[model samples]
Target: MATFTKANADYLRNTLQEAVVKCSERCLYQSAKWAAELSVSLPTLPSVSSSFDADTDSQMQDVDPPPISPAFHFANNDPEEARLEAQDLSRYLLAKSYFDCREYDRCAAVFIPSALPRGPLSPTSPNSNRRTPTKAGKGKGKDSGVITEVGSEPPSNALPKLSQRALFLALYSKYMSGEKRKDEESEMILGPADGGSTVNKELVGITRSLEGWFADREARGLSGSNQGWLEYLYGIVLAKGKTEEDAKRWFIRSVHLFPFNWGAWLELSELLNNVEELQKVVPELPQNLMTLIFHLYASQELYQSTDPIHKELDELENIFPDSQFLKTQRALLYYHSKDFDEAETIFSALLHADPHRIDSLDFYSNILYVMSARPKLAFLAQVATATDKFRPETCCVVGNYYSLKSEHEKAVVYFRRALTLDRNFLSAWTLMGHEYVEMKNTHAAIESYRRAVDVNRKDYRAWYGLGQTYEVLEMHLYALFYYQRAASLRPYDPKMWQAVGSCYDKVDRPVQSIKTYKRALVAGTYYDQGSSFGSGTTAGEPTGVLDPETLYQIALMYEKLNQLDDAASYMEMTLAQEEGPEEDDDDEAGGHGIGVTTTTSKARMWLARWEFRRGAHVRAMELANELCQDGVEVEEAKALIRDMRARMESGRSPS
Candidate 1:
């Protein structure tokens, strides 16, 4: 009996410690294991025989006096308090096991023996039945579940003083269980697709109940040491409902006190949409090893790099040596920089090591499409299909194959198929928009781009596509809004600036147009110094405005303002800049590359016409004769010369 009491007390201590330190999947397993090991009823002392001799009974009273409860010992100065604590610990064991094993419905049922199928009982409230859990330990017992009726109820006169640690675990388990069930329901709605996100009314109500509990506890000064975790949970719900700042505060508070909670860090990271927002909250977070790791992880998700993050990657490698995940990030950074040549070697080595890994295979397909390497894309598609025929990534690759072949309809079909499998596969929406544009289905294209933006506001591809579609439809106002949005997201991309400038011109805002075009000329300086802009700088927007289209556009805008001198200077500047990103190209993803927009002869011709209209007859004649000598724009040059000489021969003042 003494041994049993000590063992049970030790079990109680271990459970509480584990609950406080790490009570998610690991706790669930430990609790489940305990339940299996201690499945029998609590040990009881044998009743004293009624037929003992008078002397023996007298001696028994002296030698072996009636024992205190054998397997329910607790360290409380008050015997009653110890007994109550011990009883509560015993009663909650089975339910904790059920919850840890993800038998949530059963977990709740066992929470209160008196209340069937209605708990994860409150430690403070006699009736509240809220519970939560992280998503894990999916398997449930098949038969003879660890417990049916875990234990008898405690006396009503004195309620069991359940440990706060045990109660929190049960609450978290149910939360996780709620998410798991929601996913299952979503998966069933449209075969593979989640039809939409539905509010989990159950979780919302639980959170509402806990709010009052937290308030009451604080009022009474009974809110325990574990309150930080509760705040973290509350923040998660707040974020889901878009109480933006409130969620950040709660997460900040939780992590400041409990820096190792990875989920809280991740939640906080997701709430911050940009560097400015992230920096605002960083100082408030704990300066610890886990927080350091969080920074390394979160930076990749938040920023669109103007340079490769390989330096950060290398720093992280000091801690996570030879990490596969780090290698993948390095490869992705190269891909982002559009440095396919630099990325190619790393990707080849990765593929050679793990031929079936689909981590960056979709990107590989996109690169192939850009290069017009049709055969290579086909081979990639086959490998992706073999790996997982129904995967969204595979569908994206197949879609790219059809796109490269100019089968726009086939490409759209596959892209749509990818969406059906996973609506949040952001690239599918953008890719589908591209195909719709090819098919001249403007309305469909608009809808696809809008959906992509809804999924992720950082998706510059979708924003740019929407701008282009609006421009095509002559909706310059709407086009300008999206172009500006894309430009804000990718500030160093001259193409985005150019789009914004050109849209301003369409709307007859020549001053703004000229200003924006000039910004594009100096956009490269804004990129990180000595970084990998070489590969990532999309062809037309090469590190600087190498193609000089921006200069030409600035000159055109100046002409619109009737500023002939500025226009002539900009036109001369255009000759000083050349080649890129060929002038004929549209956006990189969907261009035919047969463009002639920025030929030197075209700029010269425009400059000559503008000079002549401004009454500079001598300069116009000089430009016209030069173009005619080279046979470049000869017909237009001759026509210009005829008009110039006619004006001179007629002897009227040139306009």
Candidate 2:
């Protein structure tokens, strides 16, 4: 819930680790083990004091120590050689702790100057020999677990002192305690440090701090034309700050000065891994600005990374804790991060800020999308309805979002709303047609799709949609006509070709259907600039049997020719594929090959019918009875049974 703002604050906290390790000899030795233990316990919310003995100020006495290297012997007087190996170990521990706690700004703040001190350079006066300790620690810690800062000293020619490991542990605790030590320090420091020397190299290293300068300027309503600030920022980024602070400051300033400057925003955001700030800043700019911002954000969000924007946000919060725009900014951040909960929290705040706040609509819609918050969508609908009720596009978009979720009735309501607002909203009419089709209201779907085509002859989807609805309704002629038109618009889509084949089959045109299917196969390969393969299948071959609908057509062809056996086989195949096996195949197949038996039964039924037609009563009776009992062809067999029984009962020539 806490917010960070200023670059310097964020920088200092981020660099605290490096600062702590530089403090004392005793801390330099013990901080590593202490820091490692603390890191493991942190996620469990362990009490900080219990994780390490905060009060241990005495030197640690070990059972065995490593032998001193030849470099550490009195034989070497080089400052670098005399440097204890223990110092490097201590710095590593302190830095690790600061990083874990997300106090990156502090870590950088401490690390930059302590590890690499710069001669103090005032903006107004140039100097050569002077160095400024802008913000320095007080003394080394003697208190239990507390880091006492040794007072600020002149810039030394020797290697800069690294903080003791315990120092960072102390700083982190101070930060969590809600202490305002840093803020108090910032207020007391009136101007640049008293160093007269220009240390451009190290000064350029503090990125986050410089970024904060620009953030501050924007917050104060100062525009980007401030040349002095611009030059300073460009310098830091140009050098690529040695600490995160240098980078952070440069980016923040650049973004704040030119909110519409997507290049600057992107570079800065990328470094901090914070996109939320850009999200907030985008809507605040002009339409052109928002457009550029959208393109940039969308492009960058495409790349995957786990770095949380919350770190940058924390820094932003600390700097502008009381800004009225903070809520909107926070909400935008949450939305981009896909954190709907936090986004909603900030959106609620924005609404409180202004019930009619325009950005709230977008924020609410985004949350709805992210969280599947349908109720929030309804709320968005209400808001749009209450405001610009005559915006057809608005209503259409709202409707489409609902339709995607399969709320057809609700979708229709919005689609109708859009139609009422703009009589010529062809897309809305088309969408309404689709919604009706989803509800199985074919008549309505047809009318709506027709209206869409009538409004815009080139609306291919609308034409295709109409053809589909007609096909479902068994209007093959009409389906064919619409499908042809749709195919002409998007000639490469194999689906359109397939639909054309289906319509041809429905009209009892097998040759045409086969031709259409062949065309579909060709189109499947090169159509729509898409993959040629069938759904869920590979590209090697177009496998699988003919579609059920096609099989039905084949059966019809056999029936027209009086080929009962062939017709039955095809029909059985269709049924088998559609509803699975449900009938006795033994009767149909007649104890033979499935194909041969079907033909044999056809021949037997024909002979029995012929015999009954003649007046030879004995023959008719015997053959008909035999055929009827066989039961291979149910319809034909039943007919023979009726004829034979009637002939016997009549007793007059019995045939």
* Top candidate when judged by TM-score against the true structure: 1
TM-score of each: 0.67, 0.27
Give candidate 2's error at residue 44 in angstroms. Answer: 52
Model 2 lDDT per residue over 244-330, tens place: 344454445444433322334434444432334445544443342223323333323322112444443343333334333434555
Off by over 4 Å in 2: 1-390, 527-655
lDDT against the true structure, each candidate: 0.61, 0.47
In candidate 2, position 447 carries an lDDT of: 73
lDDT of 1 by residue, 274-382 (tens): 7687667777776643455466556666544434345556644543343455566666666555555556567667677777777657767776676567787898888
